[model samples]
Target: MDEFLKWYFSDHPIVAATLGADGYDHTLGDWTADAWHNREREQVRWLERLSAREASTLDDAIDRDLVLSQLRGAIAEAAWPEWRRDPSVYLGTIFTSMYAPFQHRLKPEPELVSAALSRLAEVPGVLAACRANLDPDLAAPLLVKRGLGQARTGRNFLTRTIPSMVEDPDLRARLAEAAEPAARAFDELVTFLETFECGGTWRMGERLYTTLLREREMLGYGAAELHEKGRAAWAELDARMQEVAVQVNGSRDWRAAMEFLMDDHPATLDEMRAEYEAETRRAQAFVREHDLVTFADGEECLVLPSAEYNRPVLSVAHYMAPPPLSSSRQGVFFVPFTPDDFSPDQVRQRLRTNAHAQMPSIAVHEAYPGHHWHLSYIAENPRTVRKVFRTPYFTEGWALYVEKLLQEHGYFDTPATLLAHLDFRMFRAARIIVDTALHCEEMSIEEAESFMSTKSSLSPGTAQGEVNRYCAWPTQAPSYLTGAIEIDRIRESFRGTLKEFHDRIAGSGGLPLGLAEQVALA
Candidate 1:
């Protein structure tokens, strides 16, 4: 399994870089259709080879389950040939490559610039290959919009951010020269995506969606079941929020109260960063003071400005974790800044997401005992499979689970803070409904955005960002709430103290809830 894993990682340069593997540093993954098929074929081979091994032969239970899950996941991914269907894959990669330097802190400044320049030189060829590989007929309109947006961002990165991030005059010259062609290519690609668009549903259909849930996620629930549960959860959240609203004011109205909270926001970018930074320190201190769980030594989080390319899909804050296999453990908690061109009102609107009420819980969600804590713990583990296979169910679910855990443990001492925390819950609950409905073709793009605005506290801009992210990765948006609910359910049933259960969960290698439950219970 170790040899097979090493071969798999080294074969895909992008995956290799992401895992912090040593070799395959100077290359990108093959963008050709032949390479795509070759990867599918390789996954098939891995499945066969892993299946031939007996599960009982593996000494550790987590190891045994991980091997099975990894193989099944590999085979499941190839079942649909989503490489042809998912335009977001290519679109995301374009920007990821562009911002790889700062996002991952992959190398020294000189080495990083040279590597970036090497990659920038190949951007045109890469975009051309992606253009050839993508099927216009399978595209969701939102994807076309998203790809075009990112492509534009990439073009701007070549012209703008690249020149600024590199200080050396020689590097700047190389960057400028390489960026010109890449800039032209990205513009051409964006135009092509815009002009050659085709009409299609983003839904994977019941069959593919079912296989994705059952095979890929190894979950027992289906879209319809999850959707219904989401509605139920939303209703319950609304009911509780109404009582709180009545207590806070005379009326049991959610929107008015939520809007009031949203209006209380940082007035400037510095204020926003300062607020997130302060909340991060507070959350980390609270976790340690309370002994919520073990944190890695020096597992500190830094608040940085979001890359221009990522703000389209990311929310007010997103955590850029260090690669698990790497020795450096610093985590970046990225907060989006208001663009300089925005007027006072626009700036206020952009900064409203980090309102004082929600910043603490959001800080907990992104920094302490959330993504950063989870990844830090996982990095310390010796198992190779743990670093290689990341199930959104466990990683996302754990983070969401901690939100409620802290709330229950008296982290929110004020009505406003508690209300803000519930607001996040309501948002995630609404996301499951929107994600399933949008991907199942039961809801239109406009409807999803409208639903977010009406049903949750999200503004139109944030709502659009949520929907666009959902469009990019079907099933992922729903994972936050679904996984959180599942972990909550497991905790209720598990026979252990809170600390034991949480430690078990944190140490479970980020397995799917179904698998993690057994480990948690044991």
Candidate 2:
């Protein structure tokens, strides 16, 4: 299993780089149709080989099941026609290939720069492969527009951001020299995407959607069942939010209460950053004081501003986990303030989205005892498969689960803070509904965005971005709610203290929830 895992990582450089695997910084993945087909064939053979083997112990059996699940998911994802239809497929590869080398300081600056330049030289080839793989007839217009936006972002990163980030004059010169062609390649991609006659739909349809839920996610329920579950969860959360709203502002008008809380935001980006940093510390202390869960040794988190390039896509905040394989274990919590180019009104809107009332919940979800804390343990785990194969079900679910855990433990003590937390929870519930509806041919893109806007606290712009993401990536948005539900179920049955249960689950790494249950309960 270790040998196969190493081989798989080596064969896919982008995946390896993202996972912080060594010796892949100077390379990129193959995006050719032949490469995709070849990978599928190899994975199938491994699947067959692994399926025939029997395990001698529970741990070994669990490892085998994890590997098997990963293989099946990879194979199923490969069979999807995304490579032939979605321009974001190649655009994402391009961004990550260039971006991964700079993400961590595992290597010296000179070595990382060299690796990045090497990738920059390969960008034209990647774009060429993208040109060859994509068919306009199968391309969705929304995805094509998104690809164009990403291409522009990639080009700016190559031409403007990379050069500015370098301090050494010689390295800066070399990087600038290498980035020109890559920038040009992006310009050409933008041109290609601009002329693309996109007539295709982004829906995965019932068949592929069901297969992903059952095979990739290893869920017992299908899309329809999940959709119904989402609706029920939404109704329940809605009722709770209404009750909280009455407590907050003496009315059942939840939206009005939410808006009032949002108005109480930090006046500037620096203030926002400070609040989040403080909240992160407060949450960490609360966890330790309550013995919520054990933290990994040397795990640390830093609050920072989002990169200029990332601000376009990341409306508010996000967490960037350390590569499990890298020497650095410091995670960054990125708070994206409105860009300088935005108007004053736009800035206010952005600030409102990351308001004071929501800071505690956001900090809890993205930093302490959420992604940063959960992933730190995964990084410390010895098993390669445990570190390599992550499902959003466990990862996002665990984060969401901790949000509620903290709430239960009094981290969100005020009516306003609790209401903000519930609002975020309701957003995830809406995601489950929209994700299933969009992919199952039940909702159009506009309708999905509208549903998200009406049902959640997301701004119209953020809601549209969310919808676009759901269209491009299926089975992910729902994982937040679905995974949380599964984790709660596991907790209900576990015969242990809350801290012990959390430790067991967090230490188990981001397995599929079913397999995660086995590890947590064992």
TM agreement with the true structure for every prediction: 0.93, 0.96
What's the lDDT for all of these models?
Answer: 0.77, 0.84
Give every collision pair in model 2. Answer: none
Q: How do the residues 76-98 of candidate 2 rate in per-residue lDDT, one tens digit apiece?
A: 77756788788777877767666
Best by TM-score: 2
Task: Give Cα distance to truth, residue 330, candidate 1, Å.
Answer: 0.6
Q: Report the error of model 1 at residue 509, Å.
A: 2.1
**Model 2 misplaced stretches (Cα beyond 4 Å):** 338-341
lDDT for 398 in candidate 2 is 89
Which lDDT tens digits does candidate 1 get at residues 424-445? 9899999889988887879988
